[model samples]
Target chain A: MTKPVLHLQPRVKTMISNATLEQASYEIMKKAAIDIPEDYLAGIKSVAAKESEQLSGFVIKTMINNYEAATEDRRPMCADTGLPRYYVKVGDHARFDGGFTGMERAMRSATARATIDVPLRPNRVHPLWRTDNNNNVGINSPEVEWSFEPDADWIDITTVHKGGLFGTDYRMLFPGDGIDGIKRFLLDTLISFGKRGLCCQPAIIGIGLGGSKDTCMQLGKQAACLRVVGNRNPDPKIAELEVELKDVANGIGMGPMGFVGSSMAVDLHIEVGHTHTGGMPISVHTFCLSSRRATARIHADDTIEYRTDPMWFTPYYRRETVIWENT
Target chain B: MLNKVNLDLPASPDDIAKLAIGSIVFLNGIVYTAREGVYNKVLVDGRELPDDLTSRSNVNFHCSPAASKNENGEFHIGGVTATASFRFSKYLAQWLDLTNTKIVIGKGGMPVNDYKNILAPRGAVYLTTVGYGTGALLGRGVQSVDAVHWLNELGIAQALWIFKVKNFGPFLVDSDLQGNSLFAQQGELINQNVEGLYDGLKEPALHRYGETGNRKDELM
Candidate 1:
């Protein structure tokens, strides 16, 4: 596990080149568009093996073939390349040549280049006028979200091309509504979008419980896109809930394309934040069958290493107790 | 076993009638891509059909291809996937009657009633792209770009694409001539057992006015 930009001095740090960052960004975009992640591929295959319905089975088998075809031909796996976006983690100790604005420009430039090079669908458009630059780059399009990590010297750029429409919802429930309320809303979302395969199950279902409405949505989206199958919440009780919810979802008697079977979800993940004492706000996000995501680790040495896992959630990131040493 | 069949493009009336609700199909010959953008243009805007659209293809796909043009103006097609079909239901009747389209291919099929009322009545059947994610496999079948319209007006996602394809599908016949639909049938079967999922699950303290508790009825 070679960390890009590892072992930097506390006082003297190397500044990463903006061009190198853009280059890494572009490569990740192509990799995410063309290659199905190994974690997701394995997860879907397991679900497909358990799928009993003939039609549902056929859909999974064909998707496997589609993955192969996409790789062989070096094309976007799905026609709807989805809304390309970035989740970047910056190291507190690391330095970069470009200012924040310059970094943003590099990302935008990379998005346009990948849109043409990978021939991405250019799906982003203005909400009012329906205007397109034909490069998938527009105002507030290809959103870049930033987070920070302490005591690290590498910038991890993760590109997630999540489908824009369907399979996501938010609800506000009272504390009295409890886990049962969570389960009910989860069922509503899954069954609602799962019908006719609109959500494109078997998917990675991410649930965000407890947070401000916007934060709730963000946590759920990150949970679905960043985490891999078989990963669980750090808290044992929450992990248990994840497992129970996964069972409840699959027991809905639906599979791929909403056919009768046992494979509605490959896995379900949950992320939480402290919320209003009176409200339990929750959001659900489904990362579809294609599950397009790839990451690049840009080290201080200007070397870029690509990987499938995002590793966005760290112990410090999810610090249950504040990490401050002094009271 | 699931029934499988191959149908030539500009399908004849006989071929349309023989398709069963759940049978898988592979298409040969020409197919044209149209979605809300093209639908609004032709049906709502009262624009004339592009020259020879029907003569070139009878199958109308609700799709946006992963396509772009290089400096040389040669189009590069990466993949093609269908969008959900239900959103386009309002225009299907006018579009079908106007063009004599015999096949409508998209992601999820239109609402069950739309199939019986609008499509079957107009001699049109809906074919759903299998998995909805098989863009690459389908892209492989596109042999040539015969023509494209509205590239300047409607962006690539909404442009009218005339693709000459071969063995170009593994689509499931969603609606037959009898107005039967594969999705509705499958939904009913799943709904029968899914009702148990809500057992002992409590509803939220407050409900949205538009919310429906009937799980059997889908949100679509």
Candidate 2:
């Protein structure tokens, strides 16, 4: 069967100049909001009892409190923004006034601006000195996972993924051969970190298997951005593995905040791609309780699209909020 | 009469480390607001803190969820999430001593070691509070943010304002001198013997001795 290409619309493409990028980031931070899915919340409530044998109510309330405080303060739910990544789908047939500056650049600009203006916590620092660049303007601020298709207008952007933290993502190291190695490594890395490393409760595991080294990581991040906090990968095999890992990792006894309980891990997602036989790579990224991603579909004529799933709803930012009505 | 205790927030790692094993203290009021990651970075970075933060608060670290106040004049704090103190305990003591600042209220107690012993003389203490109850603990009104600090390039975007709390916790004891950890000691004693179990191997003896040693005892 021939692979089918999806038509998409492209609009005016902006380079996202440093100033503009900075402004955009501030816009996202100050105004950017995420609508959490009810099902996701329900999942949290449901498994919460099983996860934490005791004080389940406390866990539920704490989770709610964390979300409430984050929303109220208008702060990035968690400090770690993970390896910044973006998966932008631009319609091939659609034409933007400025043309394409490549998805990576656009995302980088947005990330740079957000890092500074809205000033999402710059979790990206040197792996060595441990000094925080703080600007979110690291070697590579935001990674882009781009998929272009021929279409008329509109650019659909989804920032719904969770940030990937080292401790959480790199906990268990499962280094299987080829892609398997990467998969194993990601799992082992997460397990190694334990619950404390996992940080918050209701963690979502995003896995990218069978891709290039960098691609693997980006895929993992993109997977998170697309899925809700508590959903699983659609693939049966991957989903099963996710369930197995969930039980095994939780069994490690790294309960909430690594104290002692059953509720350490929550959701696990795995995204797989076919790679050359010899050099397959995989990466697993983790997002904590705070699922922080937003999406907007800007049409060629200036329209908007939003993603709504039972697990979450897109939050309306400042601009999206109606400021004034014209008679 | 309102008995209000006051303490200076911890400024240096030594300030954090020097907190004695057990001491009655009211962290007078100078400190920053931060949680584990921020705290970990601050200590590990070894970067000189902004002058104001260094001189102002006793210490700061991020606490999850939220901190709020209650109508009865108590703080309804939540998200007193447990942290891996074993990793930071020594680091904390060392910093407390250097800065001469003491006292931190969080969940769990500290490990017993030679370093913690120093706190005995320094009059430092590790205060324990209920974890998983963030709303209950932090209900006390927040006074103000002490300083603004950010790490990584993200700093350029927005400087996360670190706050200094007016009143943070009950300041209860989790660890004390003579190397006692209520959290650990209690668990250890329980696991070692089955004192609470009524239907143990000696149940038959107890049944035989029911009421008393004899019929009169049974009647009584």
Candidate 3:
């Protein structure tokens, strides 16, 4: 059977210079390393205000102080200024002056520049040979994932700082296991690796359910990167599951820093998708309390604007807010 | 059992033994920064301890600090990231036994049984530092960083650093010389709660996904 072809209108062409894009990438990386996003800042404040445990409160206060100090001193919020990971949305209408490879070169240069400018700790090392690149621009380092937006004329780039401390995990379950199996896997993961391990209590839990292993893992990454701490899935069932998981996770009494506390996780965000009848794959990714991210949009006219939130996995709605002036 | 105390480096075994699991301590004097590379070098490769390291009370840190050099070529430590302790437990235990190290400062829990059997018996304790407050902790507590060693081979991530500190903690005695571990206790409580929740659910029937399903089961 032949697939049906749909007629589509042509998109307006927009030429973006390599130099301009590279400069924008450098600025975004520098800011992300030094400053915690405003949304994350607000979440930390809210959690601190509600904290009842003495030790937990003290730790939260210190974290708040650390944020302020990092901003004022122009130093990294955490010592582990993690490996740079860019999630980019390139518009179909956008054309790079030097093509896709040109854009790749721009990103690589930007990463190397940010390493020294932000003075990010050189965390990249040869996996087997154990060689230090010093500037974090090694083999397959500065991971970038690309997606396309039809009919758009600008490119949107979101930089997520994934620290070395909080690690990622994935699991595959049979259809027979059902939601019960998911709950067990999630709870077990939290008990063993959450509060103390990487999720680091008061963490933002991102759960990806269904689909293939890779797809589920990507979904999990997106879920973990929700704009705000308490953002819920649009689907009611999944949203409710998030709330239940949050409550159950907090019930463990790990508290902030895994000491005694009432708040274990600030929020849980679950992203769901359809899977094959025989199998279900689940991936859990965590953003620690720091939850550092920054985003920027490059327009058709070569004007760049920094966004407060990337709003990944959703439609890009333009807001009136811009942090950096057009360059 | 939460007592606020100040402990001087090279502390006596009696002083360490008196510390309970919940005791909060402020560490004073010198602490050495040692990570996996340092462990591999000193313990695995059988390298001799530097005179400066052995002369001081062995209060080692499981951290790889972020530092930058000034125009004068002197390094200014901006912050410290505490690595997970479990990754280097065996080497840490061996190093402690060899050096009579009084304390090991790190984040995330280590092997409690091993610490109790090896570290505690050797007159040492495991201290837990604030994991996320790396910047604040370093900026406020650490007075100076000097006498760095092994930079040529390990780079910054695993180099040995000697830090002069003053009132450098709000550390919890997670594993004490009395053979008690705060992490072990918490793990027990967490395990009990999780197991109880799982116990009420009916077991799911077995099913397989993909050609590699059997391999996946073994891996999990």
Error (Å) of candidate 3 at residue A123 is 1.2
In order, what is each prediction's RMSD in angstroms?
5.4, 16.0, 8.8
Task: Give the candidates in order of TM-score, highest first.
Answer: 1, 3, 2
Per-model TM-score, in order, reads 0.95, 0.61, 0.86
- Give the number of the best model, judged by DockQ: 1
Q: Each candidate's lDDT (Cα)?
A: 0.91, 0.46, 0.75
Task: State the RMSD for candidate 3.
Answer: 8.8
Writing each residue's lDDT as its tens digit, candidate 3 over A1-327 gives 998998898865467888888988888887887787887777767877877777677667767777787788777777777777788888878876878878888888988877766777778889998898777788997888887776778888888877754547787777777778877777766755655545555677788888788889988877887456767776688789999987776776666666666666777888877778888888877788667788889998787999758766553221112632211
Can you write out model 2's per-residue Cα lDDT over B1-220, one digit (the tens) per residue? Answer: 1123344555334544444432323444554444445445556777554666545655433233222233563322222232334445546655656555444445445555522475445545555433322332343324554445652322321233455566554343445444455445433433342222222212111122332657656431
lDDT by residue for model 2 over A44-112, one digit each (tens)? 666675763443234445556555554565443333333454545655555444345544455556665
Judged by lDDT relative to the true structure, which candidate is superior, 2 or 3? Answer: 3
- Give the per-residue lDDT digits (tens) of candidate 1, residues A134-197: 9999988789999888888899999999887999999888899999999999999999999999
B157-198 per-residue lDDT for model 3 (tens digits): 788888888887777788877678887775565555555767
Which candidate ranks first by TM-score, i.e. highest?
1
The DockQ of predicted model 3 stands at 0.33
Which has the better TM-score: candidate 1, or candidate 3? 1
The DockQ of each candidate is 0.80, 0.05, 0.33
User: What is the i-RMS of every prediction?
Assistant: 0.9, 14.0, 2.9
Q: What TM-score, to 2 decimals, does candidate 3 have?
A: 0.86
